[model samples]
Target: MVISMAAASAPTTEYVNMYTLNLFSLAGGTTTSSTANRMVIEFGRGNGVVLNGSFTYGADGALSGGTLTGFEEYYAGVKGFDVLGASVPVLDFANLINANDFEGVLNAIFGGIDSISGSPMSDYLNGMAGPDTLSGLDGDDYLDGSAGDDVILGGNGADSVRGLEDNDTIEGGAGDDDVNGNMGIDLVHGGAGNDTVRGGQGNDVIYGDAGDDGHVNGNLGDDQVFGGVGADTLYGGQGADVLRGDEDNDWLSGDLGNDVLYGGAGADRFLFRAGSGVDVVGDFNYAAGDRVQLAPGTAYSLTTVGADAVINLGVGDQIILTGTGAAGAEWVVFA
Candidate 1:
């Protein structure tokens, strides 16, 4: 025997000998033992249940031995399930069950949950269990790739992003920005404006799209930097700045002005036209074996050196000459 109690208004009785009974469209009501021999009670919309006696299921497949009271006045829709004698509604177990089942009945009750249309202003933050795709529909927003190889975008505004703990890809769009890949191998791009980027703890790739940009302390790992257009500063903080005197190299200029350059490691080349007062300074170990190729009719002087082949140039002078004998080579004025 199976019995279910539901809240309904008025005491109504129906007799059925079957083990299973499906009750529908009930208000709030109570059932006495004499009311039925076996029972199945189903709570309809806006229904509540209050059981007064111990319930037992009979071998004949009927719900038996329970008294249900306080059918109508005890249950209310907006207030949830009210207590048997209290006017104020308290936290009820009924609401928990209803809320838990709300998701299961969503398709039948209201067709289906609809997608949000028009502009979206919220940023999506996703967790490790997701191989997730998030869109920053149309706002200055922030998206996080918490874990799992993720992709993030700064839709607009000067946005910032940190790839917390995975190999992630991030793009900053249409604004001055900062991007950091906190762990794992990552790829980052500064979409526009003066942007600052760092590959926190991995062999990372960063690009400065436009405007003056700065890179600091991007440790270990072979990294690549391109200062795209405008006067940009590139610091191969611990590695080499692959100096290609292309259209984007800010240090490769040919006008007569005091300039400073450091080739921290590896062979750093300084290419200049005549009249560019380029100064190269560093310890003998870092300055040695680096070449400064000079153009015709350029005036330069190598004023100080820690060793015979090591030299530092004072302000308003240039280092000229390249080849095997170039280091510690004396500067001569060409008329």
Candidate 2:
């Protein structure tokens, strides 16, 4: 049962309802008193929900009511059954709406601008429409920010995080993760793992931070990608971009832009293809297996312009390898 409740405006009077619900009666039980095995609150607001809060039951399965206090205390007032003729504002139960009954996966579906965290088990956390925050505490989780500009954290697992529409900030905390910035200009950081980060369709900023053999791709727009540590692979997909492979033996590909590629400290390979616009390889070390790979059947001519070697691909696209001059031809491969 998906129960969606929209928050109404504050009441004229200041009466917060600290009411206790009869779980047995609500579930249509035969006995006078019983307990609800689990309560699934759907489309709920997450204004002031803490990470590990819980509800308790008596030994006889009766509701041992707990204190539920939050932002809804001021906004979500319910009318009709009032005590002392004053309207009662519903207690903001942890603004988390559970989508499933399974023990393994905790699906938190938040409606309003809220913040929520997952359990130690694997979870599927979704920030449905608000500018919210979702944190996957510890498991191989899946997190999606469906519409609003959200903040998502893959806390300590090999997770998959997606910012579906608006400008979001995503961090893959500990394990190897796959992070995707789907639509708007986002900021993504793959932290402490050999992760794959993609800037999909916008002028995004992505970082493959502290990982070995990580992959960072700027799929479209004028994006910026940084490969923080280890042997990483970076790609500048379409618009004019900047790709930096900070350390180790990395591969940098400026696929179709008038791009700037900086092979920071490693023996890096700069890849070029047909329609790859005029690009610049900031530090191409020809002696350290740092070469340029071109697409097959690409008509190209090499020329020396002072200290740089320019591979002009006949159709107005060229790659300028800095400092190598004619010697760069030995490091250029057609494959």
Candidate 3:
């Protein structure tokens, strides 16, 4: 029973290089291959799966070990697929996994391949029907491209990454991480610290790089989030999500559908709970301090009528705050 948030700091940035997934296990667990290149696991689609050797494809296969056949083993999703994508602790599947039927964790990863896909010898690969490619280096790592269209990377520390189904691309490049793109059209990046990114259905693009705090979620579709700098918490958890709270003091949410919230400079807080359908706060910034949060017992009453700032959360849960004159009334607050 613990819930705490409100101490904000960050907003936006766009840069790409994200490559560092430090995963361990020389045989202890979490899948193998710590480095030295060569780790391919493909089958089912794309170029095609079934890299037969019966078992043992090490030595020149890179990592220099042995035995990799069919492949089939499961354990309840395994913390969302690790190594910089977040969720670490016992993620292994070398019981010689080869099953691709039930359809869940067996074919979900980089359909495009990684290390640029040039395939020096395949710098960490995972497929069974994938636009495949996987990468990881350093310490705390784990990568799971359990299906198609995959690209997973993580490094530094505290990593656990996954593109568990169709259309995937993940990057948890630094530390304090957890990434998941369980369906299609996925793209995730949480390159620094204090991170927890999730886009569990589709149409996702998330970035919370360089950081003090970031906990992002776009769990359905039509998602695009960027809160890079610190103190961030953006969740457009159903669909039609588009949030950008780029700087300090941020806590935005379009938690159901039909959302478009953006409070980009600083001092932001926009939350409208209870389904939250017709939401639109393009840049609800009144001065340098923007605010609008209502969901605690939720019996509100704030009227302006004329210019439109009606926030009556009781009956049908209406909240209309258009701008023009005294819009949103300087800034409404109810904790």
Candidate 4:
């Protein structure tokens, strides 16, 4: 003797789940718990916990497959979490996603594009893979573009940012920032405030754009660097490079490879050391207190060819002072 029952209908309650609706709503809470302020959503994998309102088929609470529309507004909080098993702590999602310690993963059937943003408070954002756009809206932020070509912005306040790999674009929007293009042909800008920027590898373009002072270095590859409007220090660390101090007093050094240097305005110092390569000093203003500083214990002689002054460092190394004459000799200094 067996009992037969009719097939049940679908649950029409439209209950909330960890992946579909705010978890706080399902728990009968209006506000997030103090400990649960951020939600971590890992894309590329569509998986999450679901809480049904009707308990149909006794499936009130279970893990279910879900999708992320990328329009979900629950990715903010305080404190950090590690993604992709990397020890790096990602930015907290406060006023953005409510999950004190709640973690969610948004599965994308086909690897999707991600746009990650931060709050007015400090944030730490890591775009682990794919071409992602990360913006630290306001506050001191830490941004890491771990893989793929990425766009990272340190919106406001002092920020620490890095383009870890591939071609990337990074900007230290405001406040003092530490910007590093760790490995890529990158474009970097230290927008305002004093900044320290480094083009770690590959041919790069860097700008210390308007600040009290800036330190910009092209660490490798053929690079182009500009000191937009400040008493800035520029370095062409390796490869054939171009460095310019656009305004105010500046110190320009072509550290290696045949390089070009420009002292755009105000009093400028052209620095050279042993193995600095054959470099050029464009716009050397003698009466403007411009000076040529040489390495310590270095012996050098100067000669005037036509209207230009040439400093012979050795058999194959020289600094050609374009359009400078004998008057340039008086400003050469030993350092």
Candidate 1 is scored at a TM of 0.41
Query: Candidates 1 and 3: which is better by lDDT?
Result: 3
lDDT of 1 by residue, 218-275 (tens): 4434454455554454543333323221133343322233333433334334444444
| Model 4 stretches astray by more than 4 angstroms | 1-61, 68-111
TM-score of each: 0.41, 0.70, 0.35, 0.72
Candidate 2 Cα outliers beyond 4 Å, as residue runs: 1-109
The local lDDT score (0 to 100) that residue 143 gets in candidate 1 is 53
RMSD in Å for all candidates: 19.0, 12.0, 15.8, 12.6
TM-score of 3: 0.35
Counted clashes in each candidate structure: 14, 2, 77, 16
- Looking at model 2, which ten-residue stretch has the lowest summed lDDT? 80-89
Quick one: how many clashes does candidate 3 have?
Answer: 77
**lDDT per residue, candidate 4, 57-123, as tens digits?**
1254222222222222222221121122111112222212335333332222112344566555566
lDDT of 3 at 285: 58
The window of 10 residues in a row where model 3 has the poorest summed lDDT is: 1-10
Model 1, position 92, has a per-residue lDDT of 31
Compose the digit string of candidate 2's lDDT tens values, residues 73-101: 11222421111111111222322212222
After best superposition, candidate 1 residue 279: deviation in angstroms?
Answer: 15
